[model samples]
Target: MSSVEIKVKRLNSKDAQFKQTLLSSLSLPMADDEAIDLAVLKILAEVKAKGDEAVLSFTKQFDRLGVSTVAELEISSKELEQAYQGLSAEQKNALDIAAQRVRSYHERQKIEAGCHSWEYQESDGTRLGQKVTALDRVGIYVPGGKAAYPSSVLMNAIPAKVAGVSEVIMVVPTPDGARNSLVLAAAYLSGVDRVFTIGGAQAVGALAYGTKTIPSVDKIVGPGNAYVAAAKRRVFGTVGIDMIAGPSEILVLCDGASNPDWVAMDLFSQAEHDELAQSILLCPDAQFIEKVQASINRLLPEMPRKKVIEASLANRALLIQVQDMEEACEIANAIAAEHLEICAAEPRKWAELIRHAGAIFIGNYTSEALGDYCAGPNHVLPTARTARFSSPLGVYDFIKRSSMIEVSEAGAQTLGAVASTLAHGEGLQAHARAAEMRLKK
Candidate 1:
């Protein structure tokens, strides 16, 4: 397609209607559909009632794999080892490098941000602090069929392992009884305790509520289809879940000095993820924007997934002319993009201006793709402006904390009077009496 023929929206940041237009365009269809919710509810109820039988039935219906019992679904350790051994040397090497980098990064995160118990004593001899502990078990759901994401296994499983989770159970669908060896290898490498060949909302239900075979998990992490997302939302209180992610998104803030083609491909990298994925470029130079547009047109046809990229670029992509890099940064903060790239002469200078982003790719050499794979940061990120409130999946997600309080006689004397006064004021006589009884006569 010609550069002019591409339908990507072009807007100037100074336009009067720019804010409204941008908001409308950036809006995602995240609202739950009634049909999907109903379907998920039914599946969850069935799985909860029937347990392993329901899981097996759904696997057969959805994945077209007939198995009389759920025991047939569990992948053995020997099978995992054989999968690892079956990989080509190049694939094995790539998986090893990615796993090592991901593990190292998460281990650092565990030391810095993962839970740790701490306590301190006051003058009145009252001790107060937090007791941090990792979740006993976690379930990770990896998408299969359309594509096999070994990276998803590493990203979700490694963090839980680093946080000292005792068991990490993984569930992936195997349509037509086809298993992706690379995914199994990744599971083996990441030390996942169990692998189950079940998927969809049924798999999520099995994870949330324990079955005869599949043990219940403390939390479920990883991406899935719309049904999986809905199931996660429904089962949230029953079991913790990572954020409900939307489509992948990337916002590029270029200083006009970087190569236009490089910037074009970076935008394409995210757009190729799906038709709903968004890719935007904010630059001060109109000429550079045009050059990038030209490069996009020139290079887009060469992409293997050209149709999906074209649809994404035409429907969701944008090239906005900003007044300057400062204005671009302001716009980026408002967008709160999943992936932000500052491709400029001094990327760090602009990076300081960025306040909200799932991950920031700095400098010309740092493509968002690198961060997606071997750049030592979790690729599972917040989407649809969720970075404003949420964060990328990390070691912290697998841990919990409990408050610890110990009060001595002197401390109780001081605290009981205040507690009694407040409780009585609130008309809770039982609470007032309980606190007063703790006080010395």
Candidate 2:
């Protein structure tokens, strides 16, 4: 184990410079590159022009897999079934349980938060309301270059399926002609309509613009690397995207009562994700903060990804000393973290004070890791302070709402005068005339 002492910033909420320091530290470095954007734009245009041939070329060049036709990149149903059957019993059981939990949670979200068609008739017989309908098709981009994410497959696909989407096409990169069986099994379990072994900007382009083999989708959802993010941003108007997610983050509000080791490990969780991931602990007890620091120093060496965690901690991690739980909640709201953990004696009490966060884990026992996988809540959450206005991926993200309006002849007579007056005031003669045309003579 490496004996290097990790250097993390320490701050006190009472200090005059605390706010400024916190804000500066929380700011994420811009990951975009002009060269990457230009490359992505070129790839998108090429795919748009040459269709399947261009996609095949990029697949061979980037993923190092030479396939004669784009159709060959598509994974067959038999292969998906075989992948599922081949998993060890424990792995199969875990996947089945996680899928079931996720499906159940999304099914509930559909009932409660899902859109509905409702209309109310006015006294004059006019009816107006909204009609909610799921997108016909969607594409999910699952990352596969560095790690296989079966959980992501379940998270992105199941919600669309629950939202009543007709077709769910998934794209996962298979580097060097290697495919992850667990990811395929997840697609099978989540009821993905199609699976393509393609990724990067080219896959996103194919999904955004239909090729001969792959169909265009109404929206694209999922997470990927920097190039994929740039591609998604480039194709926003052509198709809807989930969000441009930043690095993962976690903010813990502790009352200095929980085990120091547990809190230390919790901080390590997000830090281990990557070098840019952020982890911060807010507690009133300075002694407890020191203990947690020592715990971090002692336990971090045990982590296999210690170098990553060390870099993340050194760059972005913090051990904050707040005045009390109330101050901690105020700070948490300002940060608007992706994951917020209230580890205290009265976690719910402090949780009630939190106004903004992507997801909240209450009490010492509820770790952020649980919510990431089997906690029945979506792991696809808003990041980079976007949670201040946005929310986690849910059934609502997969559906669209259309206004429903039916004007009765008598109703038009009653409403036309108001609309005509407004339209004429706005100098819109066409609008006024259209409203007048609907009125009775």
In model 2, which runs have C-alpha deviations exceeding 4 angstroms? 1-4
The positional error of residue 360 in candidate 2, measured at the CA in angstroms, is: 0.6
TM-score of each: 0.96, 0.97
For model 2, how does the per-residue alpha-carbon lDDT over 271-316 read when each residue is reduced to its tens digit? Answer: 9888889999999999999999988988988898988999999999
Q: All candidates' lDDT scores? A: 0.93, 0.93
| Candidate whose TM-score is highest | 2
**What value of lDDT does candidate 2 attain over all alpha carbons?**
0.93
**Once model 1 is optimally superposed onto the true structure by TM-score, how far is the C-alpha of residue 293 displaced, in angstroms?**
1.2
What's the CA error at residue 421 for candidate 1, in Å?
A: 1.6
For model 1, what is the error of residue 93's alpha carbon versus the real structure, in angstroms, after optimal superposition? 2.0
Clashing pairs in 1: none
